[model samples]
Each structure stands twice: as structure tokens, then as C-alpha cells.
Target: MIAHPNGTISTEVSDFLLNCLVRSSSWNFWLSLFLSFLFLLAMGANGVLLVTIWLEVSLHEPMYYLLSILSLLDIVVCLTVIPKVLAIFWFDFKSISFYACFLQMYIMNCFLAMESCTFMVMAYDRYVAICHPLRYPSVITDQFVAKAAVFILARNGILTVPIPILSSRLHYCGKNVIENCICASMSVSKLSCDDITINRLYQFAV
Candidate 1:
């Protein structure tokens, strides 16, 4: 039970309603449809890129491996976020269960950082090829790409696991309305009755 301002108590929160981006007007609903179409397009393109890279042995170098990794990240991000956004806007299926919300929080946090690191490595790959062309083949090998992939996963997973855990440990106190389309750390933490400054600081530090 959770205490209220007037000496009352309420049951614990079990689920959260995902809010639409624009609930104030019905006319803006079409924008959600448009954005949903764009997400679908992006996912399709990335899917094709991944398939092509996997099928073509000639594209098995560091550059294409890094590109495929970025494509994989895009697909994951779209899969995690776009479907729920579409559901909220089209079908009004806004209620996300408590555990599911936190799970989404973890995946979103982890994969986004991985995607950024992948991009950074990709830029470095290009830098090596253009500036240090003589040593490019030695420095940016298939094994180097593999190690980078492992590092991205390990680093991001270790760092971001704490985000959802820390947020979930807070006292939600029966508040269940999430003010964002996605289960972002800040949005979820703000629903808690306890202090969330630590969450904010950790998120910023990461």
C-alpha cells in the first residue's frame, strides 16, 4: 500500500499507460501514421542491408562488418520503439506491464549506447583507411571488427544494466502513467515517489 497526501492508501502500481505524443488534438494523429511508415521503411532497408552483407562473402571486411553492425542496431531500435508507438497511436493499446516496461528500458538504454559506439568505431575505420592507408589492412581487420563488436556489447551491457535496475528499485508508490511514448529512464524514474537524482546523475555520467 502507498500513502496519499490525505492519509489514504492505494494499491501498488502494476502497469503504466504509454501516452501519445500529441493527445491534445486529433488532427495530429496523422503525424503518428506518417512516422510509423518512416520507421517501417528504415527497418526494411536495414533488413535488406544485413541480408545482403550476410550473403556476399566479398563484403566480409571490416567496413562492411561495421556497417552491418550499425544496420543491426537500427533494426533493434526500430523493433523496440516503433511497434509500441504505432500501437499507442493506432489501436490505443497504451498499457505496458511493469516488468515489460523495465525490460524495454534496459534494451533501449543498452542498444542505443552500443549503436553510438559502433558508429564511432566505423568513423575510426574510415579514418584508418584514408589517413593511414598503408596500415589499414593490418589495423582494421576482420578480427578487429569482431573484437570491437564484443567490446560494444560488453561495455554497453555492463553500464546500462544498472539503469533499469536502479530505476526499478525506486518506490513507484502506485503512480502508473508514463508521460512518454517510450520507456525512457527519466520518464519512468519521475513516476517514483522516492528520490531519482542518483538515476539522473548515473544516466548523465554514462
Candidate 2:
């Protein structure tokens, strides 16, 4: 439910209309084509990398584990954002359901943070391998990678879960048009009929 300062609570949130350029414009047509090409390229590259990492026994090491995690994160991000963007651009279908928008927000936030954490872990793995070669075998083992996986999930899940929760509690009784191709947190929050300073600060701190 959305609470308003005037002692009114509403459960009638409307679907958010995503903003895109005029579908008839030649520029938009070219732009959409370009975006589609990039999306396909990215997906193909990441999918191949992920499959290779999964099937190759020689690549079953700590560094490759982190690499595969990065690939999965990339795939998740692409799948979450590209399809909706293409829908908006190609078919002029821009409305996104309320709960689905929040779900997208959560996935974007969580996976993005996970990618950064995975990169950090990868860096540490390389550091241990290069600086402490003899100890690398014992220090960065399969168990260490497993623990790092848990750490990434736990840390990002705790930090990112509140973004949608806090965003949903705000009153959005007016202007449901989201001035972006995707359900970006800022685009959605800006339409709420309430103060969003807390949301902004919390997202920035995260």
C-alpha cells in the first residue's frame, strides 16, 4: 500500500509508461537496430564464455569460477534490460506493471553489486596467486571460492533488498510516466508524490 501525508492510503497504483522516442522516426529506427546488434553481440559472447567455463574441466579453478560468475552477471543484466527496451522501441509497448518494475529494480541492483564483488574477489585471487604462489594452492582453493560466493550473495542481498521496499512505500498517486526505457530507480522515484531524499541517499550510499 502507498501512504500519503494527507492520511490517505492507496492501493491503486497504475502501470508505468516508459518514455521512448517516436517510433516512426528514422533516427529511432536506426538507434533501435544499433542497440539490438549490441545486445545480441553481448549475449552471444557471455553465453559462449559461460558454456566454455562450465564444460571445461581444466577451467574448474578459483579464478575461472569468478570469471564464470562475472559472465552470469552480464547475462542476467542483459536479459533483464534488453528485452523490455526492444519491446518499447520496436512495438511501442511501454507499459510496465508495478510489481514487475520493482522486481526489475531488485535484479538490476543485486546483480550489479554482485558483479563488483566478484571482480574484487577475482582481483584478490590473482593477487594471492602472483604474490604468494606457493601459498596460492592452499589459500585460494575450491572452498575459498565457495565462501566468496556466499559472501557475494549475502552482502548484496542484504544491501539491495531495501531499495524496492523503500521505493514501494512512497505515494505515487500522480504522473506514472517513467522517462526512461527501463524501470530505473530514479525515474520511478521521481514520480512519487512524496519526499525521496531518503531513497536517494540510501541508493548513493549503496
Candidate 3:
């Protein structure tokens, strides 16, 4: 239902997309199955990495601590997303509920932002370690890393909270099918028969 810039409204496109997905042949199923299996396997490997990090006392330095955080984030992220995606491939319930869809988007966005921020902070640490070797120990302390992690999480949490809350309040009429693999904000807004200028603007801002 997105209102085009030309003052035209987008027709409900979910049914058409759903039909196409439904009609996907055996090859599509196999491809999806293989990919989902690979994703799950990757998650398992990350879990092993996490366990190894925990068991090794020598891996308690700032860099390994960051790696552990990364492992934890990877585990959480895959846990959040991969299961549902795999279910869609195996189960019959392909459609995600509106609230669930938005929630997924919100969580996914929060994690993505946090990951970006964490990597950026890690890069800053590396820069300090390389470019200013003398002050690196004083500058990138454990407290600083903890603070940076907290800041990253808090910033993303604050910025992403409004998305689900605001998008959930928007009118959707009868359109409920999502075309993409996941129910993203853009796709959901596109289902509306109302003006989605605000949604698009917010999406761009995010």
C-alpha cells in the first residue's frame, strides 16, 4: 500500500509473491534446505569456538575477550534468525504474524547495529595498538571495552525501539503476505494502502 512519489498507491503484492513461492519446484526446496543446514552448521562451529574461548584461561586478553563477545553475538544472532528461517523451509506455516515480523526486524536491526558498532570500536582499538603503541595499554583498557560494548548496545536499542512500535501502529488493511524471506520494515510498509512516506523516510534514517 505504499504511496508512490507520483501519487499512486502500490497494490497488495503479497498474494502474487506468495503464489510464486508456493509454486517453487523441488530445486528451490533443496537449495533452501542445503543453505539452512549450512547456516545451522556454522552456528554449531561458532558455539564450539565460544566453548574453547571459555575453557582456555590464556584467552582472557582484550583481543580474545572481544573475540568471545563476537562469538556470543554470532551465537545469539543465529539463534534469533536461523531457526525461524529453517522452520519456514521445513514447515507449512510460511507467513509470519505482523507483531512477530516487526519484532524480528527490530531484533535483527538492533543486533546488526550493535555488531557494526562493536567492529568499529575493535578497529579503533587496533588502530591505537598499532599507531600509538606506547599509550595503547592505557587507552584501550578493559573498562573502555566494556563501556564501548554497552554504548553500542544502548545506542542501537534506543534507535531501533521506535521501528516496531511505530510500524506496528500503521494501517495494513487486509494485506498480510511478505514477499522477502524475512518480514522487513520496507516490505511490510509496502503492503499498506496508505501513504508510506513516513515509513520510507524512517527506514532511510535508520
- The candidate that wins on TM-score is 1
Instruction: TM-score each candidate.
Output: 0.93, 0.90, 0.84
Query: Which 10-residue window of candidate 2 scores lowest in summed lDDT?
Result: 20-29
Question: Which residue runs does candidate 3 get wrong by more than 4 Å?
Answer: 1-23
Per-residue alpha-carbon lDDT of candidate 1 for residues 38-63, written as tens digits (9 for 90 to 100): 99899889989999999999988889
Candidate 1, clashing residue pairs?
Answer: none
Q: Who wins the lDDT comparison?
A: 1
How close is each model in CA RMSD to the real structure?
Answer: 1.8, 2.7, 4.6
Give one digit per residue, the lDDT tens place, for model 3 in 1-206: 66757786655333212212545657568866786787878788888888888899887667777777777777777777777666666664566665677778898878887878878888988999899999988998888878887888789999988877777776675556677666667877777666788877877798
- Tens digits of per-residue lDDT, candidate 2, 81-145, equal 98998888878788999899999999999999999999899999989989999999999999999
Candidate 1 matches the true fold with a TM-score of: 0.93
Clashing pairs in model 2, backbone N/Cα/C closer than 3 A: none
Please give the distance, in angstroms, between residue 36's alpha carbon in candidate 2 and its true position after superposition. 1.5
Tell how far residue 61 is off in model 2, in angstroms. 1.0
Deviation of model 2 at 77, angstroms: 0.9
